[model samples]
Target: MSKSITITNEDILQEIKLSCKTPEIVEQIVSRKVIISAAKEAGIEVETEELQKAADLFRLINKLTSAEETWAWLEKHSLSLDDFEAIVYSSVIFGKLSQHLFTDKIEPYFFENQLDYAGVVMYEVVLNDEDLAIELFYAVKEGEMSFSDVAHKYIQDTELRRKGGYLGIVRRQDLKPEISAAVFAVTPPQLLKPIVTSKGLHLIFVEEIIQPELDNKLRNQILTNLFDEWIKQQIQPVEFVKLFELGS
Candidate 1:
């Protein structure tokens, strides 16, 4: 026979406390309460078809493709259909609230902060020896060797070597200050002189610089960010009591 176990509400709360998840759980509960309260205050209305579409999108996002999969997911998460609907309804409220408050501000925000979103395509090789990094940097710069040639011959990691050490599209904020200064200052298709960091010396190839575009995707991103900040402010003044700890 298969071994079985059942967890009571007391067991769940004990585990949560022991795992030091009390603050996180409490914060989430308070945040949700605050959001629902805000939605009610703002008179946000959710129609049936709109809610259905939100549920479908939620299912798609979570890969609950069919009724069987959705039910399986619900069981795995210890949630019923009613719980699922409530979750989807909250998500719908969040999206609607975000758009309602911040839709007009996205364009202005994008224009003002465009530089922060500017990105670069780069190839990098990390070397333990600063002397060797300098030599290779010069080698690539002088056209004696291509960046690929250095990556293939010098990079020890299999994946890095195969990809020619491509670092993908990186924004300035994602890089070290010194490295960012040097990388962003250089023209594309040029090799930067090696920069020393704690990990190793970096010889970077600047492939291209990508300017930020204020498209539909970026507008939505701005709206979500602005809304999240606003939510934090709204929740700050509210005092939360931990009723979960009071359960006997």
Candidate 2:
């Protein structure tokens, strides 16, 4: 004999909150539904062969060598054959639709935001104490101590301290607005004074700036970002309803 338990919608919401994934899971479900709808509207087609190829790739990734192994994999994931096929078909359609819609927009978007996309190499020291941050900045500026040595000595994070506070190649938009403005304003080998932010004070040392080029890698990245932005905008007006509501 076995006993079954009934869970309400509120129970599900509580579990999601405890897992710290409430809003993210909701957004993901909405995004998937919206993307699938967009794919259908765009008349994107996924043939039997394409779906089979996707299934083959999935099987290969999972090391499912035979039909029985694949079936076992599906069972493990609690998916029927039809369910797995539908999932693969939608994924293929989504990929095709994304490429179809955003492939042409990559170049212009890249050119328009070239400076923001350009990579900057910098060193940073962040301190919670403003006075200590200012003191360290002046110490480095007056040549009383080497910046690298000072950063290694004072940076709180173990990984960053070991790296001597070096923040490798990054885009302008990757940094906070205040830090970005101050750092980009100074030339290479120049250190910006302590900047106050909610996090604390920051000392910036700009090393070099790498200009953005429309290479194959960057073009692909820009296209993906544009597609994601377009998808978000498309889904913004979509209304999602709870399938199961508590009794009134």
lDDT tens string, model 2, 37-122?
87888888888898889988878888999999988988987789899887888778877988889888887887889888877898
Query: What are the root-mean-square deviations of the candidates from the true structure over C-alphas?
Result: 2.0, 3.9
- The number of the candidate with the highest TM-score is 1
Query: What would the per-residue lDDT of candidate 1 be over residues 36-153, giving only the tens digit for each residue?
Result: 8888889998889988999999889999899999999999999999999999889888888787788888889888888777889999999998788888888887889999999999
What are the clashing pairs of model 1? none
TM-score of each: 0.90, 0.79
Model 2: lDDT equals 0.83
Best by lDDT: 1
- Judged by lDDT against the true structure, how good is candidate 1? 0.86
